[model samples]
Target: LVTIVAVNQTGGDIPLSQLYAPNSKIPASGSANLTDYNRVEEILGDTSDLGRGATLEYHPDPNLLVAKTKDAPSATLDCSVGVVAGGTSDIPIAEEARIIAAESGLDVVRAYDVGVAGLHRLFPPLKEMILRDVDLLIVVAGMEGALPSVVKGLIDVPVIGVPTSVGYGYRGGESALIAMLNSCVPGLLVTNIDNGFGAAAAAYAICSRMMKKREE
Candidate 1:
């Protein structure tokens, strides 16, 4: 149900243009370029006898249609910020974080439910943010609260840690909050338990300050 039109970019004869005829890797014979031949028309001609559809439609190459390019913005008025969460329980936290971060003109990039137990899923998004030179990072973790510390150690950016109430117990999130506050990571900022919005606000403030300094 689809018709494909391809121009020979190799400066050679159309590879499979002649359907009924033998196909060859022949060189461009004359000055008649690949554009001079209509592949879609040739294909339609072969199936013309089976005629059901009355309309003939022509579509240009999609890449050509989308050829417009853009330059990166000159100012950090809308600064880039990264938000990551350790497990599925922290997804709502990440969303809250995203909303708060946006209030401070930060464009939030989320990596939700990146499993800390596996560690492999965690690294790629973190590596990407490092490559992008993100203004700040917000890490949300529940249970033992180890993920934020791990993330803080790996990246050069300032990290704000949010401890969520994911586990079951009398203490529950309190334990995670205590763990995060007492983290060995030298410069990690810890928020109260289940306080993703606070963590995001903290990161946003840092980013806003950095952006202002750049303007100065």
Candidate 2:
């Protein structure tokens, strides 16, 4: 028999001692006692089939804890650290963020091409960096300039948006900059278009503040 189960590891134990199926939407806090085991298989259908063993994928749930790797980094840090994530337009932003961070003597984690177009691609790496306890997140996106806003909504850390000139025509970069400036997400920051270095500088400043706060 092939069975799939979802366990919440955020709180150190699964609430109500229950496991959810992949299709289940786990609430932040709740109790669901699924009585029919066959229903899960029906939902998964032939998708769970593997050559000889079952494959399990971990999908994040806002309400429940997703299992983290054993060797995951703790949320405490020794120095200023940040993560630079890019989407769609990947040429210079991620690289520039790393360079700026390094020059400023800060640790930087880079995740490339995690734009909203392939939305799910960004979460895992983002989560990993969060686990590593980064002090800030810099999201570089061109075209629509939406990735930063999306990331800010999911994470509590400060997000600096770097809009690049990856689109065609003069209007392309301007439009992206406008979109970033007009982002409705509260406390979101927008740097000048194609300004990865500026974003990293802001991140370093934030890290400096964090260090000061920790010392206080």
How many clashes does each candidate structure show, in the order listed?
Answer: 0, 1
Q: Which stretches of candidate 2 lie over 4 Å from their true place?
A: 1-77, 169-172
Candidate 2 on 1-216: residue-level lDDT in tens?
112222222322222223455455433332121222334445345433222223323221111112223332223224545554555445466666655454344677778878777888988888888898877787877887788888888888788888888865257577778887898898789988776656765776677566668789
Model 2 scores what on Cα lDDT? 0.58
Q: Which stretches of candidate 1 lie over 4 Å from their true place?
A: 1-78
TM for every model, in the order presented, reads 0.62, 0.60
User: lDDT per residue, candidate 1, 1-216, as tens digits?
Assistant: 121222122322222222121111112221111111234455335433323322232223211110001221112235688999888877776766765454334677889778577899988898888888887788888888888889988987778888888755127688778878898888888888766646755775666566668779
Worst 10 residues of 2 by lDDT: 58-67
**Candidate 2 residue 194 C-alpha distance from true site, Å:** 0.9
Highest-lDDT candidate: 1
Candidate 2, residue 105: the lDDT equals: 49
